[model samples]
Target chain A: HLDLHHYLLLSTESSNIRIYYCFRNIMKELQENFKKLLKTERVPVFLTSSGTGAMEASIVNFFKPEEDVLIVVGGKFGERFFKIAKRFGLNPICYEIEWGDYPKVEKIEKYLKENKNIKGVFIQICETSTGTFYPYKEIGEVCKKYDALLIADGITAVGVYNIEFDRSNIDILITGSQKALMTPPGVSAIIWNEKAHKRLGVNKRYKYYFDLEQEYKNQKEKFQTAYTPSVNLYAALNEALKVINKIGIEKIEKNTSIMSKATLKAFEEINLKPLSKNPAIGVSAICLPDSIDGNKLIKFIRENFNMYIAGGQGHLKGKIFRLCHFGYIDIFDTLNQISAVEFALNNLGYNFDLGKATKKAIEVISQYKGA
Target chain B: HLDLHHYLLLSTESSNIRIYYCFRNIMKELQENFKKLLKTERVPVFLTSSGTGAMEASIVNFFKPEEDVLIVVGGKFGERFFKIAKRFGLNPICYEIEWGDYPKVEKIEKYLKENKNIKGVFIQICETSTGTFYPYKEIGEVCKKYDALLIADGITAVGVYNIEFDRSNIDILITGSQKALMTPPGVSAIIWNEKAHKRLGVNKRYKYYFDLEQEYKNQKEKFQTAYTPSVNLYAALNEALKVINKIGIEKIEKNTSIMSKATLKAFEEINLKPLSKNPAIGVSAICLPDSIDGNKLIKFIRENFNMYIAGGQGHLKGKIFRLCHFGYIDIFDTLNQISAVEFALNNLGYNFDLGKATKKAIEVISQYKGA
Candidate 1:
């Protein structure tokens, strides 16, 4: 029910070359704009309905049935990719890590050295499961050395941390509409380099909607899609892109880095251990004291402050909680979250300095501003 | 670019249940508000993309590869269905009608009686390509007698005409966000009765994104979708529903009928032969004299007067021109269009009356009002 004017602004006239135009241009645009902002190389192009869609596209296009893939599982999103890969009939070799630690690149390199005919290597840039950021640069090199495609799910890192797609030579980089893009969840994108494209060219069709070749034809021909697109969502992404473009990508990365340090510093001041000793560059997953019930703590924060901080997913569930410092959020939002957590903890019969989190957040932000 | 407020005001909530609520409640209110509105049992549903998406879903779900279908071909949309049916491996029996004339139900019945194994019938309620509306009720009854599903493309008719889906026993009805809905082109709605549902349940897994089963699961839970949906488009649809609720579908239908007749009268007054004796209840298609060059005439009107009249599509291309008497256009818009056409024709070296079209338009509207 979007207005004609809204569409007229965001919509490129369906490619002028043909009458059918792109069918899913609106959905594609949302993912494309988000990826562009994240500095993802315009490779391995795919558009799907969910974050899982991106993961599925990567597996289906890259692997034949029963083909082997190495899933470096440091957190929830990593496990999700592994599940999705198995669903597509891939036999994944998972390298599991502790909730708060990155999957070791050495272990991955060792596996690749021994395994023959490896289909791909899967890893998450920032694992939402336990808030761990893997050593993407290192793992990317290892995957390259072994001649296996490095498939990175940059779902949580895309808009917040720097992801050098070309520099890292990432074969497949997947992301979604929500999280750092500041758009609502609905669309996902997968960017592939030349090698990935060549492989996809020879693959058989597994699904119609997630097919990259058709999506590419639709976009290149008319800046449209193969099916009806969600035009209103496209309009929202267009507006959000303007904001991101004006602020510049480097500035966004720097802001998130500053916010993450400040958040961690605040937790340190309160004597709470961060989930990961070497915390992810963007997110700070804090471990609530064992005496504290995380589910109750989460509910308390939501009810009292109307803030939605994510709980640990899957294996890390109830052990650690996450604080997102992503797109459209700044120092003020970070400060607010810190204060809300402090209030909830204090109300739940815990004694702590009321201004501890905010003070550290402001101090870190000031230091970063000076730098 | 659209003003952000305009975008906000024209949007709908993207959640599926929220959309269902908006649609059902708006239809309910429209019924109570309009004095002449019929209580159609087929309540409209909202989809996330173009009207074609809705039509495609209908075909993919209701018919298997071995089934036979009757395709009523008058213009592009009718022909489009034929193509889609073929793609799905259905042998579509073509019941051809001239671009501007409504297909004869008797002819269709004769074909149905002769052809065994026909499982479904596809018809365009308003042929957008040439502005003709088929006799849906008669065709529906014939299909009923033969126990075949009657699928109607009502993309251009839903908000403009009184479609009593219950009384007509139309099995599947498709409509779009644009056209008579006065919304941007993104979402489409496919409304089906019990028979069509059973048919869909038996269809093979042709697509994931377009899968009806997943959509049903998503729709039933949280009024969301199997994948990420267009949140902003949902918002826009929600807003449009409010406007429709106030106008009532009956008044909207009556208004379109009156406006349509007025335009038709204008054509007659100018000595232009009506393209169809039994014209569509919504739009007027005027066939130009061979000397006039309909395409050039349409161009002149669009360029000089900034009035966009559609040129004929497919076989009728460059031969006939059409004016929509659909949503968001009224007496003033009609008058302006007629005046523009008259001016363009005269300027293009054709002899025509200056005020005839506007006068006839007024008279027809007055007659409808008196009735």
Candidate 2:
């Protein structure tokens, strides 16, 4: 997602105020729609450029340096949370798990008990890196019991994978414009609980650029940002939010979960193993055969089939590729992606049945259930 | 000229990186052209989001905090240089002048003897606020005698007004994208003389985002920014820079000087007094009748005429209205602006003459000497 603040070279002046007006109107609409669809009124919204920017804002502003944080690490994103916290001089008691597995809440609780001055817990609702969803509701509860703010990275989970910020006791729920928001990568949102806001005031060294105090002041006054903002992207975001409000989050998440399950089942039937055993509620990751490099496969699919599937980032690069079924993607798009993968694998001498994968995905999409 | 770096929020990676790319591309193209045109082998280059950002990079990176700086203060921008230097904890010895008066290099030489720790001298090539162009060549020579770097804030002068950065022995030359460069307000550039670069190595304690060391590393490696950037703005900047290169700086400056003189002559012949008697090299600032409020007059033109002329900023507020004849404005635009001012003054029941200003402007435009 794009951070608008970094690019604005000029300090605030009343002259070019129309641009900032457009920026604020679009973001406010997104937050309004998010609250309405997700059925939450307790959301304290903070807008940022990327998923990481939102995550950093949550950690840096809400917690003091040298404070303890329980980072539930599974994929690259969770690990990033730990790194970001450490950069602020915070020692995170990391509850590590394999890429395919979700971290257990009991283990995290034990780690929190052992850690002193523990102020917050960082959790990923859906890890985009490994296609695994951590148990957010339970983790949120554990955090509340320990008097710690439960910060959830819901970049991929917010809309496609349903999350009720208030019901789950998720103190801070962060998301990006790209994944479930169905917009281009440029903006993000952070919804903090009241506890986190109070804690933010306790940490004073957060500075102005990432400073919560000034952002809060600016947002309160004009629904505007403290820095120069991306008015064009905000225009796109306003439209995207309207679409989200119309469909509602429950239906969107149900559709995404169904698409994900169908894709996973198709992979299983074709003898292709899903990367994560406890799959991400939104996207799917599957390991390619050793002969088929994920990078090359991704490149081939993107170049030949016009399908932009994501490859593993960091250490898992060239090993596993992801087929995301979130946001604006529907049953047709999912089938097309599966078909492309099957075609690419077959051409590379890795036998995979295209017909069966398509049939299975269709069946689940037609009979998808929502609660 | 907004110094973007001062206000930019760094945590937004995509926007930060996008700003970096946009700025880098602008800096690269400008430097490449300067090198090709000047026939230089290699040169040190820098990119910042605001003209102010580039100015800060030039000041803080090139000199230590304890160094003495000789500031030539004539207009608001010249005063800004003093304030910025003071922000970096630099002790400034100012050769102060009244608002419309030109900063005399002879006066600076007398002050140079009194300040012993002076490492550099800061002055604006064009005193944008007052429309007074300082004698940079003379000032550069004076700084050379005392072994002090001559830093030029070329924000309003670079393209519309020409300066031989190398030939004049100007140690630091800085500019912003919005003014004479014809780009939107998002990027700024700093091209340092050999002497300034040598001093950069010794300075530490600079903040992370504005740090020169990291920018140098990132620019050389990937043409990528060290942070998230605004790609859309970068695209806009690319288009802007293309226009600058096509016209060449000499042609741009020649046209601007012609307009400046024409506008000034028009003001004089019509009995309208200009802000500065020696006229700023690039822009022409004219004072409204004593009866007409400058801000209200500007507002009337903006609201009624749809013409956006700048009102006097800071202390000059309600004193003079500035018409930017720099970057993209042509003969017709100048004529229309004069007409609008006539209409506005007439509407306010203050002015008597209608076509006199236009005739005077045309006469000066035709007679001014240029290649």
Query: Candidate 2 — which residues are off by over 4 angstroms?
Result: A1-75, A78-103, A123-125, A150-179, A182-193, A199-208, A223-225, A369-371, B1-219, B226-228, B268-290, B315-319, B349-352, B368-371
User: In candidate 2, residue B312 scores what lDDT?
Assistant: 81
What local lDDT score does residue B73 receive in model 1, on the 0 to 100 scale?
A: 88
Candidate with maximal TM-score: 1
What lDDT score belongs to each candidate, Candidate 1 first?
0.70, 0.69
Interface RMSD of each: 7.3, 10.2
Candidate 2 structure quality by residue, lDDT tens digits, B34-76: 4443234345344434566566666667776677788888887
Model 1 lDDT per residue over A150-249, tens place:
8988877776766667776678888765667665445566787787777874446333445567777666555666654544444554556656767877
Question: Candidate 2 at residue A51, lDDT?
Answer: 65
What are the per-residue Cα lDDT tens digits for candidate 2 across A318-362? 988788777767778889988888877777778766578778777
Q: What is the lDDT of residue A289 in candidate 2?
A: 74
